[model samples]
Target: MEGLSWSASGRDIVRDVDLEVRPGETLGLIGPNGSGKSSLLRCLAGIRPASAGAVRYDGQDIRGWSARRIARHTAFVEQATEAETDLRLGDVVALGRMPFRGRWRGPDRTDREVVDAALARLGLTGLRNRAWRTLSGGERQRAHIARALAQRPRCILLDEPTNHLDVRHQYELMDLLAGTDRTVLVALHDLSLAARYCDRLVLMHRGSLVASGPPGTVLTPGRLRGVFGIDAETGHDRLGNLTVACRGVARDPA
Candidate 1:
């Protein structure tokens, strides 16, 4: 995205932000609540039209592209999703194939196979027949991810996907996302998870880009204290991965 800006309700939600994600790279978008992460993701996904600037995929501008055409190349998973109808899990996953299917046609063998693979990948195979309203919060999140994966898109943008998940499932989902060959732009609140899994990190603040670089550079103690209002210590864990241990809330220097 170049000079991307989005506004709603007479206020700018995303400023003139400039960003790019390399092919097959995992880029983590991190910031406190109300930092415009969600809005930015929506703009990037073409779910919301930017008030200004452009969004391009494979160097082709997507401003005038159809929704189905965009969905063919990218999949977006929101922070919270509610199923309007009581669709089965398998059926929900199958929705990802919609962009690829003809308007008058139903899912084919390839569609079913892709859906099955997605369900299994997310450990939702046992719940494939379960009703949407009957599943727990975490299950719903996983199902949504399964739906995205079934799209078989080259890129995926997710907003705080680990919100409803347990610790194990959080790691599992992060592993799946980071391990995938597709380009990933994920919004996350977990600093440690972002540090561990993301190849690069983008820090947003008050609807603008604050910093962008490797986790080591972006999640510096000063940045954390300034942007997040937290006093924290950073170090490597036992496995030699970056870890952030927040001491407590930062107090005003007065």
Candidate 2:
């Protein structure tokens, strides 16, 4: 996206921002609460129209593309998605294949295989028959991710996908996303996870792009203090992965 901005009720929620995700890379979007991370993801996924600028996929502007067309290329998983109907877990995942099927077409062999594979990937195969309403918060989040996987999209845009997951699932999901061939743009609050898994990072502050680069470069102590108001240090863990250790809230200089 170039010069992307979104406004609501006469106030800009996402200010001028330019961002690009490299193919087959996991890019982390980090910011303080209400810094417009979610809004930026919506604009990039083309779910919410931008008040200005353009969103392009492979250099082609997606200004007028149909929702289905966008779905075929990218899958978007919001922070919180509720199902009105009490659909089965498998059925919910099957919805991802809708972009590839005609209105009247039912699940074929390929669709079933894809959905089943997605279920197993997210470790939800055992709960495939469970009612959506019966699942716990973490289970629901995994189901949504499974649905996105079933879409077989080239790119994925997820907003705070780990919000409801446990620590183990959080690491597992991040591992899966980082290892996948699909381009990933994920909004996250966990700085350490983002620093460890993401190939690059983009820090958003007050609805604009503040920093964009490798994890180590973009997540410097000064940037963290200035943007997040936290005094933190960056270092490599025993596994050689980058980690952020926050000391505390930033204190005013004496």
Candidate 3:
């Protein structure tokens, strides 16, 4: 995406956002509340049209592609679900196969294999037969991701994917994304997780991009304090992983 902008009710929600996500790399989008992270993801997924600029897929304008073509290239897992469907988990995951299926045709052998593989990858095979509504929050989130993976998309866009997951599951999900060869662009609130898992980070503030680079460079203490209004120190662990520690900050005098 280049200079991508989004608006709702005449208000610019995302302004001139430039991003590039390539295969075999993970790009973490981090920001404080209302910094346009979700809106940006929506634009990238083509769910929300760019009000000002354009989004390109493989050097072609995305506006020239149909919805099905876009779906085949990008899979989106949103932050929340409000649907009341009582479909079984497998059925929900199998919905991803619709794009690849012929009209009036059921899932073929390849579709079934892909669905099953996605289920197993997300550790949801045990609940494949259970009603989606019966699963826990974390389970539901994982199931949504499984559905996205079933699409066999070249890129995945996730919005707060770790929101309802436990610590173990959070790490597990990040590891899963990191190990995949597909491109991943994820909105995350957990700065530590972003730093630990993503190859690059993009920080946003007030609907504009503030920083973009490797975690160690973009997540500096000064940048965090300036954008997040929190004082923090950053360092490396024994394995040369970036680590963050919050330190007390002096309040600004009015």
Candidate 4:
């Protein structure tokens, strides 16, 4: 996106944001609450019209495409789940294949195969026949992701995907995202997980981008202290991965 901007009720929620994510790379967005992370994702997914600038997908302007066309190229997973239907897990996942199917037609063999594979990929095979409303929070989140993956989109936009997941699932989901060949843009609050999984970080503050680069460069002690208002140490772990530790606020002079 270049010079992207958005507003509502005369207030600019996002301002002149410029960003790029190469194919197969995972870019993590971090910011304080109400910093416009979710708004940015919504704009990128074409759910919210940009007040200015344009969003390009595969070198074409996304504004000209229909929602179904956009779904073929990009999938979005919001922070919450709302299942109004008694749809089974398999049926929910099969919905992702709708983009590729003819209108009023049922899924073919290839579509079923894709749904099955997606279920297995997310460890949802055991719950394939279960109703979506019966699953736990983490399971529901994973199921939503599986539906997105079933579409085989080139890019994905996720908002707080780890919200209800435990520590183990958090790591597992991060690992799963890191291993994918699709380009991923995710909004996250867990700075450490962002450091571990993201190839790059985009830090936003007050509706403006504060920093953008590799985690090692963007998540510096100074940047953390300045943007997040927390004193933190940054270093590399044994595996050469970036690590951060909060050391509390800086002391004031007497």
For all predicted structures, in order, the TM-scores are 0.94, 0.93, 0.92, 0.91
TM-score between model 3 and native: 0.92
Put down candidate 1 lDDT per residue, 121-222, tens digits, no spaces: 999999999998899989999999999999998899999999989999999999999999998899999999999999999999888889999999999889
Q: How far is candidate 1 from the true structure (C-alpha RMSD, Å)?
A: 3.0
Give one digit per residue, the lDDT tens place, for model 2 in 1-254: 22222222114677778776778889999999999999888877788877777777887777899999989988999996766677998999999999999998899999999999999999999999999899998998988999999999888889999997899989999999999989899999999999989999999888888999999999999999999999999999788888899999999621
Higher-TM-score candidate of 2 and 4: 2
Worst 10 residues of 4 by lDDT: 1-10
Q: Rank the candidates by lDDT, best first.
A: 1, 2, 4, 3
Best model per TM-score:
1
Clashing pairs in 2: none
lDDT of 4 by residue, 137-240 (tens): 89888998999999998898899999999999999999999899888899999999999999999999877888999998899888787777888899889998
- Candidate 2 error regions (>4 Å): 1-11, 82-84
lDDT of each: 0.89, 0.87, 0.86, 0.86
RMSD of each: 3.0, 3.2, 3.1, 3.4
Model 4 residue runs over 4 Å out of place are 1-11, 82-84, 249-254
For model 1, what is the error of residue 159's alpha carbon versus the real structure, in angstroms, after optimal superposition? 0.6
Ranking by TM-score: 1, 2, 3, 4
